[model samples]
Target: MYHESVMLNECLDGLNIRPDGVYVDVTFGGGGHSKAILARLGEKGKLLAFDQDPDAQQNAKLIDDKRFTFIEANFRYIKKYLRLYGIKQVDGILADFGISSHQIDEPTRGFSTRFDGDLDMRMNQKAEVSAFTVINKYPEDQLHKIFGMYGEIKNAKTLASAICSARMNAPIQTTGELKTILEKYAPKFKEFRYFAQVFQAIRIEVNQELEVIQEFLEQTPELLRDTESRLCIMTFHSLEDRLVKNYIKTGNFYGEPQKDIVYGTITKPLDAVSRKPIEASQEELARNNRSRSAKLRIATLSE
Candidate 1:
């Protein structure tokens, strides 16, 4: 398993799985959560999972359970893929959205700041827009936007300018080369954080994570069964968590949900089961460092 499914027990709690209820693990990275779901299910219970990464496909092969079905595709097409198996609705859906540990540890895929690998941070190896493309080919303004919006970097313009100037001389092909160019802009006291934020911006741009996540969340209303159904999402970043929090509270991804002034109500298909997100317990954090930033939010279909 490349990534330890963060907050396992908590995710299962949010799932509220029934012995025979149908479930979907949208981000079945290591199959930790999927395996757990299966453990709680009856023989008849089914688990349908999706992960586009070839590495994840290899891990999926280790599972011998007939109740599990792995879809070798991105979860953005959740509803479309589920329909292929004659599944219209499921009792629950779980999404653990972020890069896996193996992707970072492998060094070749270039997801970790600690690695000197090539600038290839595509979650799906087949994806065209890699870190190289984002850094070397993207317009200065677009780079600035990605850095600012995705990375939340305060000096986004300066970072973008640095990349543009560096790339003009020669294309930045590797994570090390990109880091060297932006090293001057990195904060002296907090170099690691600066580089992390910068890398995060490029990776997000390369993968179109936020947009894809929004699309995935947008489809949950249709995939989930009414009232009894649950949608559990675990986000590792603020941009993702904010969108999930807002979407569950409001049908739209915008600021505030539209309201019926006369009735004083906002009728959304989903409602937040808990007002705040669930964080990993101290025990889980000690066991796995990756669970530190995980925030699990659960919602259920409304009446």
Candidate 2:
């Protein structure tokens, strides 16, 4: 399915785009945001788009403009890859952390709980790990940690045990098989939500989602070319949003509040663009259920 970008207008406005500026769209799935950025660029402006999934590169529109370049690589290596293009810094960067509709709607790619397909949720198909390895090969204790930390499942221990037990009989290879195993443990009232949580946890572990975010956040300041350079990120879950928000406010994840630090004590490289996260409007939410969980956080590089 064609992937429609979330928070399109809000993100573009957040970037405060300039026609002559260079920008990066880190998650270029379906070219949704990348296309929008191109429309706003002048003949002299440039846009670099990155998507690791090679199939996604096929979606690149036939724009003959020399201003646009598509990079086939995961965004975690964004800094290194950009440097290869002689781009040491950028004017603005936009990242939509939500899984693209292209990945979810394609049952064969297998990102959705609704789809009865192979449990392969790697954002970068080139990645070595897949849901199969995470579920079948990962130690029970590690699985438990992923469920508890990433899924935040209340019955993490039991669920992890259940998965381990089932895999002993046979490998949990597909979404359908995994769902059957999880269904036996899901509470009656919260069955569906619990399954989603458990599956999401597995996906996160398989993809190393949290670690990627940490690396991406740490690399943000180095990418901004000017003092006013912007970082606009759209996150779907509270965990991801928390990382973005905290990173923008404080360069470090866990430390005493920086607001109390004396002058010259330490300088934060980013300045908050909004006091609070921005959410989809009522109209946008009604049209797209995916927009409901979306939260946009913006920050500008400090001088």
Candidate 3:
């Protein structure tokens, strides 16, 4: 089970890649973008790819090309990894931010609501925390906030109460087990969509995906070359999209505030490429349903 990169052609076109310049594919799932970058590069060009999942290494296809290098690490450490490789900056950086299809389709991976497996949703296997730990160990208040804030679920407090209460009877070990407990709290006549949302929230917290993206976005300007350095990010959910949108627009998660007479402030380090995000074309959406939620945002580092 491997992930098909969403909006593949559209992202490549947005990058405006230079044939002889260095590039980075930060979320190298299935190595789809990395492979495309490889095809577009000349012998003098280079592409560096990063993925925390070891399984992703098997999907990396450009091992034979000296122009390409794959690092088994998170994109949040892109600057560090690049520095270690004697590289300082890249012409373009592409990030497809979300869980891979491979993780969701594999039942044991437990990333999907449809799966009935252990509640282990660590994208990086080395991470100590998993959904099981969060569900069973986190305080009720923390769980309530995560569910309500990330999942945007109604009655988040009630749902949190149910989990805390049920786990005391028996440890919630698997997705199926947790689903059974949460289902009771779910409105009896409500659609299945609500339950799915709750599960998604848990997965997000378990992986610390939002925090990682926040760190990664903060470093893009420092990692890219001064002129025409493109940063393309594809986010599938509202929370993730909001972070990307704000960062691109104001160079901070919060919108920029007016300058005070007592303190001076400068403008952002990058400029938004489009006033709004670029959505996949109708043709692309029809071919891939997963593309439906994807919003692509691009920015150029200030020179």
Candidate that scores best on lDDT? 1
Q: Alpha-carbon error at 155 in model 3, in Å?
A: 1.0
List lDDT for all candidates, in order.
Answer: 0.89, 0.86, 0.86
Candidate 2 lDDT by residue in tens digits, 50-100: 888766778875555689999888788989999999989899999998988
TM-score of candidate 1 against the unseen true structure: 0.97
> Relative to the unseen true structure, what is the C-alpha lDDT of residue 37 in candidate 2, on a scale of 0 to 100?
91
* After superposition, candidate 3 runs with Cα above 4 Å error: 187-190, 257-266
Residue 7 Cα positional deviation in candidate 3, in Å, after optimal superposition = 0.9
TM-score of 2: 0.95
Query: Lowest-scoring 10 consecutive residues by lDDT in candidate 2?
Result: 255-264
Q: Give the TM-score of candidate 3.
A: 0.95
TM-scores vs. true structure, each candidate: 0.97, 0.95, 0.95
Clashing residue pairs found in predicted model 1: none
Between candidates 2 and 3, the one scoring higher on lDDT is 2
